[model samples]
Target: MSHRRPLPRGLRLTVTDEGPGFPPEFLPRAVDRFARAEASRTSEGAGLGLAFVQAVALAHGGTAHAENTEHGGAVTLDLPC
Candidate 1:
């Protein structure tokens, strides 16, 4: 699922997945380069996905957030409108 909300200062875009979500320890380093949870170490991902998202958001003077919701994992990008 995706949600787009317009705040007074910017736009909030959130994307969510119904998978098992990120590991507790991995959440803190989810945006770190080459960081991956054991559950994902064997996956095809290089673990740079969230890092790239964070980079782009920071470069654009915005912010990036990732967390596990009741449903699953979610990544939100708050960018200037």
Candidate 2:
């Protein structure tokens, strides 16, 4: 995992990890609750991580995204400081 540093004042910070990225089509819907592109009753989660992130960002007047990392994959969050 890695993080951007020394954000300007009024900016919130976030970190990202390298892993299997989700599909591009799913990007638009990633912030929705229970909105898993790979949703499965047999899986562990109830599809809430991205949604939670989105909620936090929104609450802080910002946004979130999931994307393919140059090296792998990552999730980013931007929020008001």
Candidate 3:
């Protein structure tokens, strides 16, 4: 799912997926480089996706956040309009 809304000084874009959410312990460090939820390191990612998102958001003077809903996970990027 995707959603967009206007803020006072920016726009918020939220993307949600229905896959299993990130592990509970991984939530705090979700934006860190090479931070993977899978302990075995067998997942398909190098764990840089969220980190890249965060970096891009910061470079644009914005912010990124990750959270879990009842059914899945959501990432929200708030960027300057």
Candidate 4:
């Protein structure tokens, strides 16, 4: 976790997985409602997890981010403390 400097009084939380990571094309829409990576479509999920996370961050006057790391995917939520 990290401090939100010059932005707000909050903390940024990040979660990452050591999986195949997300597709490049899906990065832009990763936080969209119901958006899911093709590899996850076959799994059990409604694809709203990230969307909900983003919504909560926004509601808290913060933001959310997603990205594919060298070894996996990462999702981050910045929220007011």
Residues 1-81, model 1: lDDT tens digits:
999999898999999999999888888888887777775356598878889999999999999978999999999999997
Q: Model 3, clash count?
A: 0
Clashes of each: 0, 1, 0, 0
Worst 10 residues of 3 by lDDT: 35-44
Q: What tens-digit string does per-residue lDDT give for candidate 2 at 17-52?
A: 566677778878877898886755477887898899
**Model 1's TM-score against the true structure:** 0.90
Pairs that collide in candidate 4 are none
| C-alpha lDDT of all candidate models, in order | 0.89, 0.74, 0.91, 0.81
Q: Write the per-residue lDDT of candidate 4 for residues 13-64, one digit (tens) a residue.
A: 8788888888889989999998888853668887899999899999988899
Q: Model 4: what TM-score?
A: 0.80
Cα deviation of 21, candidate 2, in Å: 1.0
Model 1 regions more than 4 Å off: none
Candidates sorted on TM-score, descending: 3, 1, 4, 2
How well is each residue in 1-81 modelled by candidate 3, as lDDT tens digits?
Answer: 999999999999999999998788888999899888886976588889999999999999999988898879899999997
TM-scores of all candidate predictions against the true structure = 0.90, 0.75, 0.90, 0.80
